[model samples]
Target: MNEPFVRSGNRHRPLSEARARAARFAGALQDLGIGHGDRYAIVMRNEISYLEANLGAAAIGAVPVPVNWHWTGTDLEHLLTDSGSKVAVVHSDLIPAVEAHMPPGMRIVEAGVPAEIREVYGLGDVPLTGRHPVMDDLIDQTEPAVATDQAPPLAVIYTSGTTGLAKGILRDPVRPEAVPGMMRSLSDLFGLQPGYTTVLPAPLYHSAPNINMISAAALGMNIIIMPRFDAEEFLRLVDRYHVDSVQMVPTMFVRMLRLPKEVRDKYDVSSLKSVVHAAAPCPPDVKRAMIDWFGPIVKEYYGGSEGGAWVQCTTEEWLAHPGTVGKPAGGAAIRILGPDRQELPVGETGVIYGRPADYWPDFTYLNDDAKRREIDGGDGFITVGDVGRVDEDGYLYLSDRLNDMVISGGVNIYPAEIEACLLRLEGVKDAAVFGIPDPEMGESLAAHVELVPGAKVTADDVRGHVQRSLARYKVPKVVVFEERLPREDTGKLFKRRLKEKYRPAEGNA
Candidate 1:
């Protein structure tokens, strides 16, 4: 197939060209002594070459590990050493961040910063110091590597490290017989199909987008990638490309909704057939607005990097049950269990566990088998530490991560519910709720809010808003304003960072 993968702000790469480049990349890695089971890191932005590098590594049975381009210093060092990555394919601009901390003798392949990426980041077009090999030159000089029959393995996706250090989730190589089932599951969850045109606006380094891109390429879909997500530009791309589907997070929906009515009305997004969102729990109001604006195309799923199982919900299902994440996809099942590991009755809140349908592969935590054991609740059920409950109709409603729940006077408080309420208030751009020490209550809820540009809002305004919607105790005991909040590109808030900042010192009342 000669279908093209278009990178917004850059040129299109035909599938044939992409395949050839991937093969050459595989040949080059083989020349550098990379072999089966070896891991290499790709620390670049959202560019076509990022996918090419991944394909190349798979061609030779080597796994390509995608590093979050935003990581630096100790986090960067820890990932590189922990994964035992032998080579790093880095963008020209990001080399500076990796040079000081890269593992010894690690080969570096520098991808030149494309003008599009430079423009997005406001970087100047500058020459590299020639300390590392250029990716293009290597591809041009090497012949395509011979293909292997080995089943490709899943990429090692690291967790967000909210509770502690990031751990790589590794899966066994895909069984050849399981390929069809795996593809079907991915297509069902991501809305991917052959010959369809789709836009991927999230960062490629993110697990969902990375897997989606790989699936799109394999399916011969016309792929349009954005260097960075701009709310208006996304709408324009859908109209311009007649984009049929997309995968996004809730934050993108919020940003798009924040656009003026005229700006939102300017684009014709009727071409969208499937708009799937995951990675975070979307506010019910925000999701309802999107379904109204985009028709019933908006869908949602709940899963993790562990590759165990997934739960999905359609627009009609969501509208029917309003906050439910829908029922588990065919073959999958969800179980809510209390602290003692006994299954909880429907409508009772507890930890959520999932078991993959018959077709999915099992995974392990790289270098940390004990961690894997902890998540496994026996009988093939595993959880990522989320707290939620299933309704009478068997639809799941997420409360919050088990680690993020606050216990004040023996009452469990889910910050996500409060944050959702905070987002509904006018002038509130973003919010994070967590618990802090209190002498009397043992713990008290604290909120940090980011306001819309030039928005005039106060702590009392936020407290009153929450109080009107929820229990008085749910209203944050303390509210702080900020110009911005720490959020990952995928829309996950770094509440761990905020909690650490407000943690009371030992012995302090």
Candidate 2:
């Protein structure tokens, strides 16, 4: 625990150093009027300061709201305003874009862009707003505040906004006595332990990675924060650091699997003990390939930002129950409910709902209490609009989000099925399937495909490939090729953007 606990580029900071800085930051926050229960926004990529900001906010019982740096215009304004964030900690280089949208009276703290991040994104000569308080200077000038004994306030996490505007999930704060149980749940779910070296390549704005980072810090584990995800560099870091457990998403697995055999083989990833994934439904083929490559260490959990992981499966369990996300985890319960809100029998598709473990605090969508009541099953469970079924053995298998389901020609179609089939096609790097307006069928499936570099597949090739594997009705009526698909590093696709192109004009059908 005394060793350097966090690494970014060539810089390494130990947990003790981080704690001291966090305390100083807490004092600075108090001076700036951010107190217990007040929210502060963190707008940055994966970096040491991102971790520090979260820790500092938590030290004084304040909540940290991590904002996705990619958002702009209304999306950005909506989050800052909706969360009622009293302050925002932004990277100096990002000030130009963020400053314009920041709400009036919200304070700003600039975390200077590290060279590693600037280099990775190929940033050059980005100007900063010199008017804001610098994070380092604040820490230096402020006196360390006595850390609070109460458990930290739950962070205000926003949804991925794939369907619409992101909603802030404001969870109830954990009582001090409940801290140990919550920590144990987090440790078990994330495969973290004290002193275990790990690498974090996913963006910190996402819930899974953000939670992982916080838990890893609490356990005093050695941490390596990648500026951004680079398939080769990830392998190299694992080899160099002799890292143990690491969390990832299915998209990263796909990218690494696409690497040339020699390139993937060059790194000694044998040191990896656990490789965990979640955030989206992983295609079976991709999961099988990952298990084969990473040994039996590939594990997965199914949950959302609303509640902690409620279902999980180890590699062995997953192999036994191929597509299952696993039985209820950590004393949680799952139920698949049909249209009438009655629980469906095993093997029947319906909206997936779960009662999270008692250790997880209850939550409501900020400024949308009625929406929270809408999802409540009224039987002690809640759903996030996912569609799935459970096997006789009680293992859950995900189909797709309820919003993503398309009814065409009076037949229901789940885009995840077609997307998985498309991924199996040769040279297909990524694909997104969603419903689009159609006169005859009411709505037709549209597939947006991203091919591997040098791939020369035509729209016909894409459509024919789907036709060969899946039912004709599931094959997308409109096939469009793109250089790349709009997706989060966490594997959530923004299909709304793709579907917007097909929206009918106001006066026309």
At residue 422, candidate 1 shows an lDDT of 95
lDDT, candidate 1, residue 318? 95
Clashing pairs in 2: none
- List, residue by residue over 1-509, the lDDT tens digit for candidate 2: 25757999888888788888988998999999988889999999888888889889777889999999999998999999999999999998777667889889999999988888888999866555688999989999999877777666688999989989999999998866677888998887777889798899899988888989989998889989999999999999998999998999988998899899999999998988889999988888889999999899998998788978889899999999998888898888899999999989989999999988888888999999998999999766999889999998889999999999999989889999898889888888889999998889989988999998998888899889988998888878889998889998888889988888988888886
Worst 10 residues of 2 by lDDT: 122-131
**What is the alpha-carbon lDDT of model 1 when measured against the actual structure?**
0.88
Candidate 2: stretches off by over 4 Å: 1-4, 126-128
lDDT of 1 by residue, 1-509 (tens): 54566555757878778888999999999998888888899999987888789889778898888998888888898888888888999998889888988988898999988777888889888577599999999999999998888876788878877667789988888888888988998897888889888898999887889888989989888888898899999999999888988999998998899899999999999999999999988888889899889999898988788854378899999999999888988688899999999999989999999998777778899899999999998898999999999999999999999998999998989999999899889999899999998889988999999998989999999999999999998999999998889999788888877888876678973
Instruction: Tell me the deviation in Å of residue 408 in model 2.
Output: 1.0
